[model samples]
Target: MTPEGTGRALVVGGGYAGLVTARVLADRFDEVTVLEQDHVTAAPEHRRGTPQSRHPHALLARGADLLEGLFPGLRAELREAGAPVSDFGQFPMLYPAGWSPRVRTGLALQTFSRPLLEAAIRRRVLAHPRVRLLDRTRAERVVLNDARDRVIGVRTTGDALRPADLVVVTTGRNSRLPAGLSTAGLPAPDVLRVDGKLSYTSRVYRRDTASPPDWQASLQATLAPTARRGGTVVALEDDRWLVCLFGADGQSAPTDPAGFAAYADSLANPHIKDVVTRAEPLGSIYRYGGLGGQWRRYDRIRPWPGGLAVLGDALCVLNPLYGHGMTVAVQQAVLLARELDAHGPADACARFQRRSARTLLLPWYLSTSLDLGWRPEGASVQALLARRYLARLLRRIPDDPELYRRFLAVQHMTASPLTLLVPSARGPSARARRGGERS
Candidate 1:
């Protein structure tokens, strides 16, 4: 098939990553088509395409900023829809040591269910004049040129072909891109995986606005080696609270009502349990497992084809426990946009792939290091040392507000992790030294 200049772009999934990609491609391509297998709906409801959507999700400070920049007034629209936007620093947290101090740190976190956020982005992206959504259509494999040096388009189910100048795959964690590449006579990217055997059981509860909790959201993080249980209670739209209880290693949360409540009560902190005990259940408990980190080293592939790029979970899937998946996906989308704008479609795919791999390094390290702690066999020397340092830092956070603030900044991706290496101004020794110097 012959192609026009800067012609069509195909996105082989309509999830969050795919939507963002379609939006970005719309700016450069004459036509952008998103082929999704699920029958997407207008309402903020869960679909079969994303089973994890039923669980609680967090949009980190960095992700919120990027999404707002991409879709102006998105935060306001979510706020109007009753999604709570609050300073992330003020959210109460129970760490390995004790309760984290609630202080303002200028970091904003917008809380909502995954489905709601996806629906919001989907509406905005599909509304673009250049973007089109082809729901209930599955992209069987990417069509390649005879030379196998370039991707020509995608072959959908029923042997139908959709021609495009570029084909971006965002099929997510369970992507079939590897198989598709193999079928197209190309080498599949090597997979790197670290499984922590993490599991989540979540349920929504009716929030009583008249007697609101002191904190809008709360977290009790799991500390490996001793504590395998953790949970979170975040305020969501329509006066609802999404409570998710999780366990690491061999532990798994029960889906039964009584068992779920018992799991929450077993946590080291009482915050989530207290809320779960009193709140009225709004829905059935949903459970998700097989959670861990996986990375497809697409950048390392030799003879990488032009006009093909993998973004988001298709390239790397970080354990959701750290809440880095959405943020990293947004970062990848931003990187893709920059590459296309700088180099144009003809030569941007390979460069974008390599850069995207570099972008995943930090988040992959942060996620796997903690997960490795759950399985001693998989823990390398570097992972062990990181866990030790993180444990010490968590122990100090409760007593040092400045330290907690800095940690919060790092968690939100607003500050560098190196900042944590500095001594806290509020630490007792630091204060004493400062006093002596002043005297």
Candidate 2:
């Protein structure tokens, strides 16, 4: 059936990215339908399609801001639902530069399980009159026109044909968009991958102590080359802590309780070890691995289908350690809405894809650069130099609160990456700046 004013827009996948896409589409299109392979649950539990949701997920400051803009009262609603709020500086983060300088940076971080966040967004999107969420319905391929120049709709697993004027694929890392394009007699996009061999083991614990800890959250990232183990302890709703132990380059976090604790103990930060051993256990350890960063260069496809666009992981799957994946997806959704409004439907798909490539460049570079360091075969010279520079910057963060705040700004997606490269207290003197000369 043709929609009210604009034609129907079909979204493949019902994850956070897909939900956000659908939510945006509802404003531009007459109707938006979301197709998911697994059942979408209202409970704060992982769906079959989202195994990694079991781990602690960080919603960056920019992500929270954009989400609140899209869904008003979202921050208050989430807080009411038990998602805790904390300032970014409240977290005692141990980077290669020792512990992060704890100071109120004024940036807020919304900490919660992935399932809760996804469910919340799903409810809002599905509640829209123009949006219909079809869970347990898997999209098999994108149907193309007779000339194979544009997408007409999608073909589902149940022999169902969903015809639409626009199609956005947010199916994520396991997306079959490339295969579907190939099946439709189109050239598949090239894939760029960095195999970090990353693995993580997570478990929930009950924080029953009457006295609260000094820190709200703790993150310890393994320094490359010398260290390959890291861990994070994030406070969750209902007085719980979600602790994750991770490793890269063959140092895998074990699923066994004893092994998990041992791995946490190996981390440079003693806080992670203390929380893991002291907190009362709530759930069995869940092991997740084989998460290598991969990006489909769909933007490079010449004569791209006019009505087809890919978002989120389907386009660029970053290493989750950076905690920017969700933020990037929401940003893309906002970009899509703006592109559609400005360009209209005629060229929105192609324009959005091209613009998305630009949007992901910084986050992609930042994430992959770190993942490149996990290579036992040694990183590229450029990556090595970049890492060294970052290490130097990290060393001075403790002594300089302003520098830490700036760095946190970038990490939280509120500042540009160039901010971190600026001269810190250890750099040139005030006199040197006046003379425009190097130290």
Candidate 3:
């Protein structure tokens, strides 16, 4: 196959990651097909495959920027669709140390449910001339060449075979790619698991009109290891708020209404309880319990098969509290585009995986460090010390707006984690200096 638009590309799954991957592949492939197991909705409705779509989801500033770049006027379209946009730093936030002062950092976060965002992206991607979405179709295995050295296509159920020059896997956390590789007589990537044992219950509520006019949302983060419970109430498109109450270890927010309220009341901050007490319920409480960080060592898998690549949760699943999953997926999609631009489809798999490892390292470290607190056997001194330093930084955020800005930048995936570890022109305090030494 040639480097430019003359070959077929098959993307497994049609979630946010797969949809974006298809959009990226469409620029280089003559034909691109997205095989999704679940029936995708035309509108933003919950599907059986994605129960977590009912929970609160926010697209970080960086992710929003990339999406807009990929699909022109997307931000404007989302705004027209009633998704509210707020400055990242101006939200009503309650960190471990009191409230964060509102500061206009110029970074904007568009708040909405995952289903709406995925649906919007799906609509846009499936509209392309070269792109086709095969919903309710399962990609069972990868078809390899005679030597078993190159993936030539994918096999679906019903004995259907779709030939492709490149195959991108974005089947999400529960992906069976390892088994598929093993079944193809290939070396399946080794797996690494970090169980946070995190659980949460989420529900939608009608936004209260009586609230302060400037109040857009409230984010109260839990200080892990010390306080295991936290929650957030975010404004959605339809004058509704998505409230999610979370706990680490074995403490799960109950699905029952009364117990849910009690969990909210137990949070260190009052905003969660306030929303639960004042807002009218719009939906039943839904709970999701499987929250863990898992990474497949595809980069470490030497002699990686040609024409095969992995992205999104299939590559690494992070704890959702950091909200890095979608953003990381977007970053990986961009990386895939860059790799394809430089190397084409045949040799892009290993190069893309190697380069994307840099993209996954920081967020993986951040989420796992906090999550390891729940599992003593997996916890390390380095992780504990990193958590302590972060806790101190959070405590100082109310006093230092610049620090909060830097932290926000890192949180949004715009800046490196070193921005938090190293101080700026303001110079480092005794504590920050010590934190740097520790880091």
CA lDDT of every candidate: 0.85, 0.82, 0.82
Q: After best superposition, candidate 2 residue 248: deviation in angstroms? A: 1.3
Per-model TM-score on C-alpha atoms: 0.94, 0.93, 0.93
**Runs in model 3 with CA error above 4 Å?**
1-4, 209-213, 376-381, 424-439
**Two-way lDDT contest, 1 vs 3, winner:** 1
lDDT of 2 by residue, 1-439 (tens): 1124488899999999999999889987888999999986777778878888888788788988899999998888878987777888877777664566657988997788888788788888888999998889999989999998888899999777899988999998989889988988889999988777788889999986498777678887765656688888888877889999878887888899998888887776776888887889998999888778888988898888888889998898888888889999999999988878777665788888888998788787776776676662566787667666766666676567678889889888899988887766743222321211110
Give the best candidate by TM-score. 1
Tens digits of per-residue lDDT for model 1, 1-439:
1222268899999999999888888888889999999999989989898999988788888888998889999999999999988888778777766677667889887888888888999999989888999999999989889999998989998999899888999998999989989998999999989888888889999999997766788888887777788989899999999999988886888999999999998876566887789889998999999888999999999888988999888889898988888888888888988888888766889999999988787778877877777776856788788877887787788778899888878877888899999886674433332211211
Clashes of 3: 0
Query: What TM-score does prediction 2 earn?
Result: 0.93
lDDT of 3: 0.82
- Root-mean-square deviation of every model: 4.8, 5.6, 4.6
**Mind giving the per-residue lDDT tens digits that candidate 3 earns over 138-174?**
8998899988878889999997889998999998888
Give the higher-TM-score candidate: 1 or 3. 1
For candidate 2, give the lDDT: 0.82
lDDT ranking from best to worst? 1, 3, 2
Compared with the true structure, model 3 gives a TM-score of 0.93
